[model samples]
Target: MFDMENTTVLDRPMLDELVPSRYALKIGEIDVLVISDGVLPLPTTMLAHNAEPAVREAWLNDMYLPKDAFDWALNVMVARSGGRTILIDAGLGLDPDLQLPRAGQLMKRLEAAGVNLGSVTDLVLTHMHMDHIGGLLVDGVKRQLRPDLQIHVSAAEVEFWRSPDFSRTAMPPGFPDALRATANHFMEEYGSHLRTFESSHEVAPGVVVRRTGGHTPGHSVVRLASGGEGLTFAGDAVFAVGFEQPNWHNGFEHDPEEAARVRIDLLRELAESGEMLVATHLPFPSVCRVAAEGEVFRWVPVFWDY
Candidate 1:
């Protein structure tokens, strides 16, 4: 059994010291590390799309969070099993043109944690969001970071982004073009190395990918099982205030209603089973568990060894 007593919680001051930028944990024999890619500022209004201003403010107030914007963390999970290094999601790469100024720190932080980029054998993408796949390339040209990297993504996700109609979708002003460009870039750069899978499949020894589409056409989650312990990498499936209000759809989701439905069901299952969840856009080191509270749910962040 995994020991919960050794877990430590770092305050903002200690976190700022960069000592807690990465968190280490183990699921059975698989060694896992949660690396920070820095935080990005996102308007609270954009996140609580379906909620009224008053309601959203109340929720933020309850959580002691800012009313206008949220400092969302970009956490990338790395797992080592059976002598293979697997990266769950690539963080925002070192792209100067990207709007978010605080992101794209994955490589540096990983190095600080003693991880080598060239050692990554598998890159698993939960979805194709810019923040998630940005690190797949360095400045949109080099694929030389990982010599043996094999890209894995959902088949549906590939089709959605590659479709000619993708550029004509009703997306935020400049997003459609950006999405098309990123998709085309990946196809051109990693076409031969890309591997698409169906509904649920084991990507690594103890890591399994399950399609939970809603946030995006190919949105999915990674479930790691070993030594009688399990943790789920909930890729944009839930964000701040999302655990408390699973039905509140975010503006970023391609299908808001479906996203809500998927979030509700997934949160319910995780809460009941007490599985650890590593959220991509929650607080730094975004490892938490869910607890069913009446009709909603609550976030219970894990404490790691300091």
Candidate 2:
């Protein structure tokens, strides 16, 4: 039995899950909690559209991953700084059309972790992707949240979703439609409450979110610095394969070329700074650092501190 009853898991009653769903760490004086929204299984082709089938298969085989679809880790973050609670990127809510039941666990997991929606003073979205903002659309979630919740997102992101261009993307048959509809719905529900920014904004002391459009027109990444420690919650700007193959284009990128450029730049920057990183679709608790070896980069997951 995987019992956490006598563990340091925030002292909440966990259900269904046998392992910890949240990982807590600190940066300076800021409190950071990396929560597992859950794993989203998607087709392998979606990972690298620009690479040849043989090369992609070889990489997957080297990692011991299946040749077919695999689970992509969906992670979100909660930050406490300046006496404010901030939620970064909500997780994938229920999507009957997507048939992805493994995801959308954020709501329940958050509650189990002793996080109350009403306590979230601010929300920062990296972009308006359905998976990133879907948790808000979950029934009754809105009612549970505080009325004056400030949702910070880039102005460019909101405008792009108005008539999102999927022509450049390489999503599955129904993916584009689902993304479009979900983004539209998210705006419909939370548009009026959005706190739009142009380039960068300090949501709270020691926490900054900056636009780094690549995967999406308004893609953004959040950075936290305090007490000489820094960490970046790199939304979709980086991925599991991003470090090793920064040039490979993910199928979800609207402008894959720009996305590749963005990935390469960000990886190089992180490698130099040695700041920690956590991405949306990286493995759960994707707390890792970037290491450079000449042209390519490496992913060094931080040792778990349970």
Candidate 3:
């Protein structure tokens, strides 16, 4: 019963000026800001894995999403606690050659939002994916953009990318080399400040890391608790469509089956607990609550503040 003729697709132009660069929210005493690093236009083919073309069109139509492409916002979180500035992900770096247009603006946006990048004390990486870790470097070098920042990542994730087997395994074109390069760079440049953890660990007071390990070998999520409020920073754990249809895996997932499984479980938990979610690749602001309906879930975006 989907109405194709009534479906309205997103037609907004992709530009940094068109959308607000940052959004702020609070969870307990911790101050959180969702910083924009720019957006990427990805083909719908990258989503809805294993679904028929007709089914894919129907799903997109129902959601009022463009059948041709989707705008994926590269959202990075800045968590301030006890005077310490903690960045969840480094975001895509500012390399014209390496990043696409309108991307790699995290630092600029942060500055505009009154965040002092020099004061960033800790950098917690959800995973070593290019988009997430790209901002770690400066001008394609391995040097830390913030000299005082200590890097934290999952031990398993670090080991996976650094292993010889990872280099041998086939990956999307140029991805293996890119991963190896970044992994080696991090170890060489930030080894002294790098800390690795297994499973769950507390990065700061009321901020915890949970190992998810479906999108990547060491993929994880961060939970922020304050007073009685909670928010989950889900890094590439679920995209927009993936949020509604947890069973439909993205082509970019390291293990599609495992990713789908983890997503379904996490979505159900979030819905039942009523925890707000900050997704990296969802729409602008990228803050939402997962609403469970039968087997599927829906993304209920937080209301805009004027």
Candidate 4:
């Protein structure tokens, strides 16, 4: 008997338990599912380097989050349209040095959802950040994926990783090195599968990826439109704290200033258009709409579809 709901993978005791790891919904004609890649517990300081300690602390306290560190959600998406199945971002695989053990749950969760890697026709990377590409580098992932898999990413993103700049950004020790190494490894192993794009490219009907170049020189976002509904899968272009403090700088940003500009522009556009938004680091399922409230925007999570 194939009881996918009860089947377990990777032998992770916690993963054996039944939990809400996947959410399914439709964007007009396309099928979309947001899977939880678990969470990454990062230092609170990473939330905003430019913010005053007092002001940042006040925001944290108001949100009831711990002052030291908090868990950041890692969300991955799978979209199907026009006979093409696309993976938006690969979740973190194994990063022993980063000490983030909980976040690499994407592969297992996808398996439980009956999503076979071999069926993925295209992979659209928002950027080459480890959290977004590491899962593909996992030991046996390549073997399971089809040899002709077409990976779509911004040419700027592929070029920036050659000599990534970390001077302007702030991150914990060892992160820069780990990120660089993982990206290098990924490129070396999968570069042949890449299909670089300049600014934007359409992968499938109503599914398009556009370069934003803020979070990373190659960072991009995926937009899906079909029938009359629409949605955008923002890859690290926005965060949980971004809604309240849009100007705050994230430690992981390669170019914080440009990143802020990109964030504001995307939020404003979504707010005005009234389209659904999903982001990598936002809450699970991450299905929400942006509300323009004077200066800062507001996040209005879609009422649970179920």
- RMSD for all candidates, in order, please: 4.6, 3.0, 7.8, 2.6
**What TM-score would each prediction reach against the true structure?**
0.89, 0.95, 0.87, 0.95
lDDT of 1 by residue, 1-306 (tens): 112243333343332344467778888888888888888776787676778899999988988989998788899999988777888988877667666767887766665565667778888899987778877766632444665578888899888886634421234457667766776876777778777888987878988888888888899999998888889999898986787788886767888888889989988989888888998988878888999999888899887665
**Model 3 per-residue lDDT tens digits across residues 1-306:** 112233223342332254677787789999888888888766786786567878999989987989988767899998977666789998877656544777788766665666666778888889887778877665633333566667888988888777734422224466667766776775776778778899988888888888898888889999999999999998988888886678776766777788889899889989999999998898779888999988889889889754
What lDDT tens digits, residue by residue, belong to model 2 across residues 1-306? 112243244445454578768888889899888899888888998889889999999999988998889999999999999989999999999877778888899988877766889999999999888899999999999999999999999999999998889888888788888898999899889888899999999999999999999899899999999998899999998888778888888989988999989888888999999999999998889999999999889999999986
- After superposing candidate 2 on the true structure, give the runs of residues whose Cα lies further than 4 Å from its correct spot: 1-16
**Model 4 CA deviation exceeding 4 Å by range:** 1-15
Per-residue alpha-carbon lDDT of model 4 for 89-174, expressed as tens digits?
A: 99999767667778899887888777889999999999999999999988889999999999999999999999999998899998
In model 3, pairs of residues that clash are none
Better of 1 and 4 by lDDT: 4
Report the error of model 2 at residue 42, Å.
Answer: 0.8
lDDT of 2 at 58: 94
Please, what's the RMSD in Å of model 2? 3.0
Candidate 4 has which clashing residue pairs, if any?
157-218
The C-alpha lDDT values of all candidates are 0.79, 0.89, 0.78, 0.92
As a TM-score, model 2 comes out at: 0.95
lDDT of 1 at 107: 68
Worst 10 residues of 2 by lDDT: 1-10
